[model samples]
Target: MPDYDLNRLGSRAFEQMVVALGRPELGPGVQVFGDGPDGGREATYDGTINWSAAAVGVPGGSEVWVGHTVLQSKFQIKPKPQPQDNAVWLQGEISKEIGHWIKAAKAGRPRGTEA
Candidate 1:
């Protein structure tokens, strides 16, 4: 696995992930579904393209989700992460670094890494 300075990882990578998401052609049918009242956004597509998420910059947010686009998905939360996203590759490896941007109640910078 590639090495990324999680300490410096912020919302930059996540932002790029969202933008790359616009290019569904990057992978197969994509979907961004969320539970609860924050009905956010979802995307999907069906194309034969390879892709990979290079651990760079910040995935943004406090949550980091990892998995394939059409086969599987997963995420882990630490102290918390800024709602962020990952990069899109053209290879066969399918993974994600999604960050859930939920407003905190304390209104201050959060800390730690997430799953």
Candidate 2:
């Protein structure tokens, strides 16, 4: 497979690409969200996730995930991006998302909703 130049795409476009790539494996039930605050979710899946049958070259795909699953997409615009350059920022962003989810859980808000 060829490496995709994700930097060419805007954030929402990147999210769309992610969703398109995942929908097959995640199933048709995946819910896609739009711009603004997504409550840290770009996409949400509530059912069993499996490798698409075509993905695994099998009649029926194998199970991968179950229950609520949240997807977040981050696009790095810097040319020739390196993971090390964004490591700290990525860690912080991930922590922020996790914190948001924890706070939401404590507040009894649903998994996919904003506070």
Candidate 3:
């Protein structure tokens, strides 16, 4: 695909993949968070992590980052977060932080303001 399309698809793909990883049908113990400032995504599996493939940069080297991790962000070094990075993390502390922005969003109308 073209570089523009690939860049636009990065954050979306990461969010979807993370949600897929957290699917109860697929299995449990998986959690994810997206909507980052740079349009990044974070995911964890089981409890093991490698932190390598966090930012699967654009295919053509246009300097577009793909993913972000709890410990580091691909934007720091612009290193290629290839498909091989085993992204995983722990909860407890991060859960609170994630919860800060994890609330369900609605396009319009407040929960109690309806008339």
Candidate 4:
């Protein structure tokens, strides 16, 4: 086995990789949308996902995630030295996307549903 340079993979490739790697956990029915406008999501699953609380960094046994699940991929290879050097910016971007989802839900139109 050999290790490859993951940094060379652009955001699209990284998103694809994330989908592939998550299949086992997210089930085989996970839908992946490559390219074009993502609408704040790269992939989605509308079913049960069996996982352990430890997998989610919590202390517990098994856990189940049911209903609609959205997956987003964010990878930055710019600024050289450390792409994650701007952790605050990355977190802010994620928070904004989450806020959009929450707002839509509050308005009775959850994401992935027709308005």
Candidates' TM-scores?
A: 0.21, 0.75, 0.24, 0.75
lDDT of 2 by residue, 17-99 (tens): 99898787777898988987677778888987665554575546554656888878776566335667688777777888788
TM-score for candidate 4, please give it. Answer: 0.75
Summing lDDT over every window of 10 consecutive residues in candidate 3, give the lowest-scoring window.
68-77
lDDT tens digits by residue: candidate 4, 66-102: 8988888777667346546668668887898888888
What is candidate 3's lDDT per residue for 1-115, written digit by digit as tens? 5455334446456457446644543235544555544212354344443333443564543333233223212211222365333222223334544543343224253222223
lDDT of each: 0.35, 0.76, 0.39, 0.77
Ranked by lDDT, the better of candidates 1 and 4 is 4
Q: Check candidate 3 and list the clashing pairs.
A: 53-85, 55-67, 55-81, 56-81
Candidate 4 RMSD computed on C-alpha atoms after optimal superposition onto the true structure: 3.1
Candidate 2, pairs of clashing residues: none
lDDT per residue, candidate 1, 13-75, as tens digits?
443455365555444345443442321233333444433343355455233344433322222
What's the CA error at residue 41 for candidate 1, in Å? 13
Q: After superposition, how far is residue 41 of candidate 2 from its true place, in Å?
A: 1.1
Better of 3 and 4 by TM-score: 4
